[model samples]
Target: MIRKIIHIDMDAFYASVEQLDFPELKGKPIAVGGGGDRGVVAAASYEARKFGVRSAMSGVLARKNCPELIFVKPRFQRYKEISQQIRTIFYEYTDYVEPLSLDEAFLDVTQNKMGNPSATLIAEEIRNKIWNQTQLTASAGISINKFLAKIASDFNKPNGQKTIKPAEILPFLESLEIKKFFGIGKKTADKMYHLGIFTGSDLKSKSQDFLEKHFGRSGLDYYHIVRGIHNSPVRPNRTIKSIGTERTFEENLSSEIFILEKLEYIVEDLSFRLKKQNVAGKTITLKIKYSDFVQQTRSHTVPYYLSDKELLLDIARNLLFQSKLKESVRLIGVSVSNLNSDQKKKPIAVQLRFDF
Candidate 1:
């Protein structure tokens, strides 16, 4: 049976939230993130998009491109709260909800408990509900599978919805450019262009073996994506392979005190999150980025998984002190991995729904 997959993504999520909270910022080109030399854009409003500003673009370049761009410091704490608010909204439709990030998630509503037969209409209702509850706009894509739905959501973004029925799959795929294909990064897309494979029709002509030989595992994915086939599920309650958070600074700094302040904040957030999820990790990783954009990470694993914030903070501070950077620090991120074994508690599958 054809699956009903819906991908819901917020429009310029961070920037939009900033605008909603600050009325004066509405209808203005805005970027959310630091505006200093070392900062990168975290989110760009629709008005900012007109000036070619985008997420992850250097803040210095963004200013050069859009002289009037407004930058706001990120409030990840608030973003996380809003994320949970939206998760509650998804549960109203179906249990097969898979969150992709803070502002987007996938819902497998093939058999919804709400008695709604049309996934497209369900997406419409969910979008409306999000707007009503959070005063934020969301775009949704409805399709037979996750891959198609994800692409469709991007088609009409910023408070929009797009549907890709199975019948329209071939034409849709044929008309797409090689650059837009999923998993085809900039480097890979350029390689495909050189190989004369620029569209679905071009990709369909190649055999699976030929694709695997050229693209490795991704080649097989590319071959099937063109045919509108992806068996990957909207994984729910996905194991926490890692739990961490990071933020870009407004300016490069060598101030250990200021960095420690930021680290403490993230540690608080991580501890609260892990405790809420009832999971702990044995490995701690410290990520650092320099003004020159060089990034480095250091990790240590312990014998026992622990959720102690004090332990994590102490080790993370030591890692930062040891990381000698040629340039001032531009960003810092923290993460914990090697989660505690699950043999102590009931399996997540059972705890999640209790179906069995």
Candidate 2:
């Protein structure tokens, strides 16, 4: 079946949002993050791209590259709001929306709510509507499958659209560089270079068994992509990231009450988030920072992710007790990771009980 998938990536999402919110920053290069020595850039506007300032770079390094660099603190709450706003636009087209980040998502519109059979038309219309409503530009890629669609979108960036038809898939893929293929990161690209697999053609020359022997499970995925035979669906079920919360005390606390209050709030938030994501975790972690500039984390992993709030809280709180902090704690945090959405279906539910 020829799946109609579209990949939409916003233009420098956080920085663009910052620029949109503040008119003065319009047309000027701006990075949305702190400008301190130890701070990092969370996002950079297109204008900042001229100076090579990018997201995840050291803030101090960015300023050195561009002396007039404008550094705005990250507003995560605002970004989350915008993400939901953009998400609504996707749901209108299709339910198979896979959000990659706050800025990018993959949509399966092969059979859409709009009854639109043309993925190209849907992508163009969505881009236009997004520009009209948010004044933000997005680039889109339309293709018969997820991997190709994702690559097509990046071909035309920042208010652009590109399409890869099923008929042209093999030749198009064969002509493309190995680095452009999905799942081949920098390290993988280097490894591929060492193996003389520089392009899709080179990848296709190898048999599936040979590819699998060299690359393991991922080699199978690469082999399929090379043959223009990718069949991964645009799953609507999204996996939530880590759950964590932190609190800064008014004054350093020696007593357990202050820590417990913060832990309670953290557990509540994580529990609510876990339920919403339809996932649970088996590991519980307690994060503590002492007044004397010291931080530590104690973690416990279990057989399964716990779906209950009280259970997570109990585990996290007990881990805190196990730590021997040399000084009073100034900050407290709790988190749960190692999630599995299939916990409900797995035998025994993988109940993980931590020993205090």
* Highest TM-score model number: 1
Q: Please provide, for model 1 over 185-296, each residue's C-alpha lDDT reduced to its tens digit, 9 standing for 90 to 100.
A: 7778878888889887888888999889988988888888999888777777655578887878878878878888777766655664565355789899999988889989
183-272: candidate 2 lDDT, tens digit per residue: 798778988898899998998898889888888999889888887777667666555546776666778888787677667666765664
After superposition, candidate 1 runs with Cα above 4 Å error: 243-298, 301-336, 339-356
- The ten-residue window of minimal lDDT in model 1 covers 347-356
Could you estimate the TM-score for every candidate? 0.75, 0.70
Candidate 2's C-alpha lDDT?
Answer: 0.79
What's the count of clashing pairs in each model shown?
Answer: 0, 3
Return the clash pairs for model 1, or none.
none
User: Using alpha carbons, what is the TM-score of model 1?
Assistant: 0.75
Q: Model 1 residue 302 lDDT?
A: 86
